[model samples]
Target: MNRDDGPLFGGRAWLPALLIVPMFLGFAFLGVQGGTVIGTLTLAAVVVWAIRANPEGPIEIAAPGEGVRGGVLVVLLAPIDDPPVAGVLAAITDPSRREAGEPLLLAPTRIGRLDRFFGDIEAARFESQRVLAVSVATLAAAGIEVEGRVGDDDVVLAAEDTLRTYAATEVVVFAPGEDDDGAIAKLERRLGIPLRRID
Candidate 1:
C-alpha cells in the first residue's frame, strides 16, 4: 500500500522508539539540565520534520495500465437530473474508449463544518445518495449503464478510494464551476489516468 494511503504511523513502528529512546536515556543519565536541553531540541526537530513531511500532501494514484481493466469513474459534485455537459458524456460514451469493468458513479458527502463537528452526517449522506440516484438515472436515460456509490467528503480521497476497488481507465469530474481549492488540478496530477473536468 502507498505510504500516503496508510495512517500517520501505520507501518513505521520504529518511529516512536527512535524518537523517545534518546530522550529517555538522556533524562536518566544526564540529569535535569542536560535532559531539558535534549528534550527541547527534540521537540524543535519534530516540529520541523512534521512541517516538511506534509502528511496531508497529495495522494499518489497509480495509473491503470494494461494489467487493469478499463471503465470510467464519474465523480459528481451535484445532482444531475439533466444530461451532463457534452465533454463528460462524450468521454464516457466514446466508442474508441478502452473496455473495462462496469462503470461507477461516485458522489462525495458534502457536510458542513458545523454539521460534521456535531457528528450530524445523516443529511450529508442523504444528499450524496440523492446525487447518485439522480445522476445514475440521468446517465441511464442517456443509454449509459453505471453503478453508483457515495464516497468520502474529500473529493480527491473519494476518487482514490474508488480507484482502489475499480480499475477505471478514465475519471470524469463534473463540477458546477472551478473550485477555489484547486481540486481539479490535484486530481489531474494524482489520478495518473486520463482526467476530464466539466464545469
Candidate 2:
C-alpha cells in the first residue's frame, strides 16, 4: 500500500479523543466553566494537535525472506593471523648475535580460552561468539547502535539471497582489507545493492 493511504491507522484515530479529555481538564483549570466556549475551543485545539502527532508502531525483525521487510544487517568477519604469537625465539650464543627463526606455533587463543571455559565441541563457535561480542562492543563504542538488525554468520551467496528476500534497505558488512573488497564485489554482483564497508 502507498503512504498516502492514511498510514494504516490501526486504532490511532482515537488518539484525538484521548487528547480532548486532557484539554477539558486544562480548560477547567483556566476558569472555563462546564465545557463552554473557551473550554470547547481548548478541547478542539488539543484534538487537532493530537491528530497531527502521528506515532509509528513497532516492527519485528526476522530472518530475510520474501514478503517481509528486512532491516539493516551487519556482518563482521575476523580472519586468523599468520604465525601467531608465542612462537620460538632464537637467542645469541654468549659472544655471538641473536638470530630470529621460524615461530613455534603458539597455542591457539581460541583453544586456550575454549578449553579453559567451554570444554570443547567446536572452537570456531567459541571464537565466533567472542568476535561477535567484540563487534557489538566496538560498534556501540563508536556510537553505532545495532537497533534494527544485526547478525553473524558465514556470508555466502545464500546469505545474499536471504538479504534480498527480506528486502533490507541497508546492509552493513564488516570485512577487513581484501576480505571486505571480496565481499563487496560478491554482494554487488549478487544483490545489486550497494555494499558499505565499515573500517
Candidate 3:
C-alpha cells in the first residue's frame, strides 16, 4: 500500500483489522443487524482513529517577567550520567543568567515495541523519568542550581516548551554520545536556535 493508503491508527492497525474476521463470524451467528452494526462500528472507529493520529500544532509556553532570570533550557535525553554540569555552566557567557537557575527538562523517548516487543511501555517511560531525576540530583550535588521538569520525548517540542516556559535565552541539548547527529541538527533547526551539546 502507498503511504497515503496506510492505516491511520497509531501502533498496530493490523490487530484491529484481524478482529474483523472474528467479528463477522460472531455477528453472523447473532442474526439480524448485528453484523451490520459491528461493521459500522469498526469503520467508524477507524475513521476516528485516523483523525486523532494527525500531528498536533506547535505549543506555546508563558513565563512571568518575560524570563527576567535569563534562564537556560536544558533538554536531556536518557542514560544521562555525570552530566558535565560544570562544563555546561562555564560555557554560558554571563554569570547573571545563572542567578535565576537553569531549568533541566528531561525528554526521553519511549522504547517502542519495534525496539523491544516484550518490554512494557510504562516501564520504559518510568525508567526515563527516573534517569532524569537522578541527573537532577547529580547536578544539584555539584553545586549547580537547577530546576527540573520531565517532558515529552519529542525533543523539538520539549525544547520549545521548556524555552518558553522558563523564558530561557539559550538552549542546551544533552544527548547520548551515540545519538544521531542528523536528528540533533534537525531539532536545532526546528527550535530556530543552535543547541549547545555536552556528550
Model 1 sits at a Cα RMSD from the real structure of: 4.4
The CA root-mean-square deviation of candidate 3, after full C-alpha superposition on the true structure, stands at 9.0
lDDT (10s digit) by residue, model 2, range 101-122: 1111111122344455756636
| TM-scores, one per candidate | 0.75, 0.36, 0.56
lDDT string, candidate 3, 94-195, tens digits: 346543345555555556656467655677677777877777676666566665666655666666556665655556767656665365676665554346
Clashing pairs in 2: 65-165, 65-166, 88-104
- Report lDDT (CA) for all predictions: 0.75, 0.42, 0.60
Cα lDDT of model 1 by residue, 55-128, tens digit: 45445544566675448777899876766463357556565665534577889998899999999999999999
- Cα deviation of 92 in candidate 2 (Å)? 53
The prediction achieving the highest TM-score against the true structure is 1
**Cα-based lDDT at residue 128, candidate 1:** 97
Better of 1 and 3 by lDDT: 1
Candidate 3 residue runs with Cα over 4 Å from true position: 1-70, 83-86, 90-95, 98-101, 115-120
Query: How many Å off is the CA of 168 in candidate 2?
Result: 1.4
Number of the top-ranking candidate, with lDDT as the measure: 1
